[model samples]
Target chain A: MIGELELILCDIGNTTFHFLIDDVEQKYFLNERLPDFNETIYYISVNDNATANLKHSNDDLVDLEQYVNFKTKYKGMGLDRKIACIGYDDAIIVDAGSAITVDIMKKAKHKGGFILPGLKSIKDLYPKISHKLQFDFNTKVNLDKIPLCTQDAISYAILQSIIEPIKKIRKKQQIIFTGGDGEFLSKYFENSIYKKDLIFENMKRIINANNCIA
Target chain B: MIGELELILCDIGNTTFHFLIDDVEQKYFLNERLPDFNETIYYISVNDNATANLKHSNDDLVDLEQYVNFKTKYKGMGLDRKIACIGYDDAIIVDAGSAITVDIMKKAKHKGGFILPGLKSIKDLYPKISHKLQFDFNTKVNLDKIPLCTQDAISYAILQSIIEPIKKIRKKQQIIFTGGDGEFLSKYFENSIYKKDLIFENMKRIINANNCIA
Candidate 1:
C-alpha cells in the first residue's frame, strides 16, 4: 500500500451528491455540479445523470463495481448496497435518503433487499399526484401513535413505512443505519448503530483489496 | 322521503373523479373536464382543485360534509375518510389509490388513521427526484419477499409498505378495502373484504341519514 495515496470518495444518490475528502464531507445537489479534482476519485451511484456528471475517463473515475466482489440476484446491484456489505460480518444495512434500501448481508453473501421512496421523497409525492396538496417534512412529530392533522399524519406515516417492515423482520444480525436520515432512525431503533462517512471507509477497503489483487 | 327522487353520486379523488348514476359507475380525470349534470349531485373530495371544478352554485352540488354526521380529530377530515366510516359497525377501512388512507372506525367512533403515498405515486416519485431515473409501476413482481432489480424492488417495497403496517395493527374488526388498488390488496389480505363501489354505498347511506334529519 502507498503511504501517501490521495483519495476522494463520492456517493451519488437520487436527491443529493456526497463527497468525502480528508474526513470532511461536502454535499451537492445531484447532477448540478461536478468538481475538478486531482486525487484518485472513487464513486458509487444509483443515478445515471449523477454518474455522467462525475464521468471523466474510464480509468480516472473508479465505480465501486471495480472493487466489490459479490454475487447477488439484483443484476444491477447498487454501489451503495455493495459498500454497505463491506466490513459487515452479518447485518441489515439500511440507507435512508432519497430512497430507502434495506439489504441483508450474511457471512458476505448477499441475501436480497427492499427499496422504497425516502421520507422526503414520499413528502414530495403527495403534491405531485394531487393538485394543491401541501406537505411539511421538517416538522417534528410523535410516531408512537397516529396523528390527526395532515402534516403530522404524513410524518408519522413516512417514518412508520420504513420502521414497520424492519420491525417485522426482526433478524438477529446487527442493524447498520447510514445516509442523511440515518441519525434520526437511530433514535427509534435503539439497537441500531448510526454510521457517518461509511462511503469513505468503503473506499479505503476497496483500495486495500485492489492493492492485494495488484 | 320522496319515493321518486333521483340520486347522483360523485367521488372526487386526487387522480380520478368517479360518478354513479342509475346504478352505473362513470369515471373521469380530475380537473380535466367538468360534466354537466341536472340530477341531485352528491360529491366527496380531498383535492380543492377537483372540488372547485365540481362546484355548481351552493345548493346544486352537495358536499359529503353536509350529509355525513361524525366527529374526527382531523380538522379538514377528507370526505373519503368520512364516507368510509359510514354504514359500518366496527371496521378498518383502507382506500388505496393516488394516496393510501387506513382509517379505524370502531363502534362508529373515528379512531384516527394513517396516510401514505399510493403505488402509482410512489413509482412517479423516483423520476421526479432524479432526472434519468424512470420506474414502471405496471410491471408485475413478487410482493411476499424482497426483489433484486430496481423495478421489482420498488414494486415489492410499495406493496409491503402498505401491507406490513396494517398487518402489524391487526384488529379483530372487519377490514374493508376500496379504491383502484383495493382489488390487489384484497388478494394479499384474504380475510379482508373487497368493496368496489364503497363511495356510492356511503352516498346512499348519507342520503338516508339526511332524509331522517329532514
Candidate 2:
C-alpha cells in the first residue's frame, strides 16, 4: 500500500460506464453520462503501476491485473459489486436508485438482496401500454407529503419498496444507503444514514482491499 | 310511490353498466357485489312484480328514461356518478377502487369528478415497467391500513389522492367513499362515510329523477 493510487474502481449500474480513481480524500469521477441503450455493461480500470492501454474484456467484469498489465495479479471482478463492497469490512449495503439493490456480506458469505423498479421507471412504462395514463411525472406538479393521487402514488411506492427490506434486515446491523434517491429513503428511517459520495468511498475500499494506496 | 322499497339508490363510475334499478335495497345489493367478477352483475327482481320487467326500465332514474328497455338497462345511464349522488341531496362523492375518482355535485352540477388510477393500478404499472417485480394481489386480501413499504405506499398514495382532494374542495362536506377499495379508505377520515353500492344507489336516483316509478 505504498503508492499514490493503487487501483482504479469501475462501477456499472442504472447508467453504465463508471470509473473511480482512489485517492486519500476519497475523491473519484464517474462517467454516468453513458447512453442507456447498450445491452451490456463494460468497464475497466488501469493500475497506476503498470501500462498497456487498459480496456474492458468481452465479459461484463474486469480483470484488473490483465487490463493494467500489472506484474502482481488479481482475478476478474464485477464493477458494481466491487464498488458496492468497497468501503465496508463487514456490513450490509444497499444502493437504491433507478433500481433498488440490497447486497449483504457476513464472514465473506455473499447473500444477495433484491432489485425492484425505481421511481421514474413508472413514467417510462404507461405510454407503451396505454396512451391514456401518460405517466408523465414531470408535468410541473407539486406533490403533497401524503400524496393526493396517482402521481404521488408512483413516487411513494418506489420509495417504499427500496427501503422496507433494509429495515427488517438492519436489526443489530449497520446499514448504509446511497443512490440518487437517498433523500427519499432517509425520510423513512431516523436511524439510517445517507451517503451521496458512495462512489468515492467505494474507490477507497477497493484500494484498501488490494493493499494499494490512493 | 307504489313501490315497497323505501330507499332509492344509484351508483356509477368509469364504466356505465348499471342500467336503472332505483331501489335502496337493490343499490345495496349491487354495490356490495361490485367486485364479484366471477358472477354477472345483472339481477332480476323477477318475483317482485310479474310486470316489473316491462314497466320498470329502472324504476328510479327518469333522467335515463330516454334510453329505455326495462328488461335490461344496466348499460343505459352515466356510470360512476349517479349512485355516488344518491341518498345525498347535495355533497361530494369519492370512489377509490381500481381508480380514484372525485366527483362533486352542489346539487346543480350534473356530473363532476376526475379519474385517476387506484392502488392496484399503480401496482400493475410497476411490474410491467420493472424487470423484476410482478404485481400480484388476491381479492381476498384487503388492506385497511397505510403501508410502510412499496405495496402500502402504492395503496396509500392512491387512497390519499382521493381523500385529500375531497377534503380540500368541500369543507365540512360529506365525503362518501365507495367502489371496490372503499373499505380501505373509509377508515382514513373522521369526516368520511362509505357507501358500498354506489352504482346501484345511483340507478334508483336516475329512476326517480326520470319520475319512472313514483
What TM-score against the true fold does each predicted structure earn?
Answer: 0.86, 0.45
Native-to-model Cα distance after best TM-score fit, residue B161 in candidate 1, in Å: 0.9
Deviating ranges (above 4 Å) for candidate 2: A1-8, A12-96, A99-117, A124-132, A135-138, A142-200, A203-214, B2-92, B102-116, B129-131, B134-175, B185-192, B209-214
Q: Candidate 1 chain A — worst ten consecutive residues by lDDT sum?
A: A1-10
Off by over 4 Å in 1: A1-6, A12-17, A27-36, A42-64, A138-140, A212-214, B1-6, B13-17, B29-36, B43-64, B130-135, B138-140, B212-214
Quote model 1's TM-score. 0.86
Please give, for residues B1-214, the per-residue lDDT of candidate 1 as tens digits. Answer: 4335566778877667788876778888865666577656777776777678777433477776666667887755677778877777688888887788888777777777778788777767777755534667634676656667767766777777778878766667778999888888878875789898887887777777677323
Predicted complexes: DockQ each: 0.62, 0.07
lDDT of 1 by residue, A62-90 (tens): 77766677678776667777787787778
Q: How far is each candidate from the true structure, as Cα RMSD in Å?
A: 3.5, 12.6
| i-RMSD of all predictions | 2.0, 12.1
True contacts kept of each: 0.74, 0.04
Give, for candidate 2 chain A, the lowest lDDT window spanning 10 residues. A66-75
How is the predicted docking of candidate 2 categorized under the CAPRI scheme?
incorrect
Give the DockQ (C-alpha) for candidate 2.
0.07
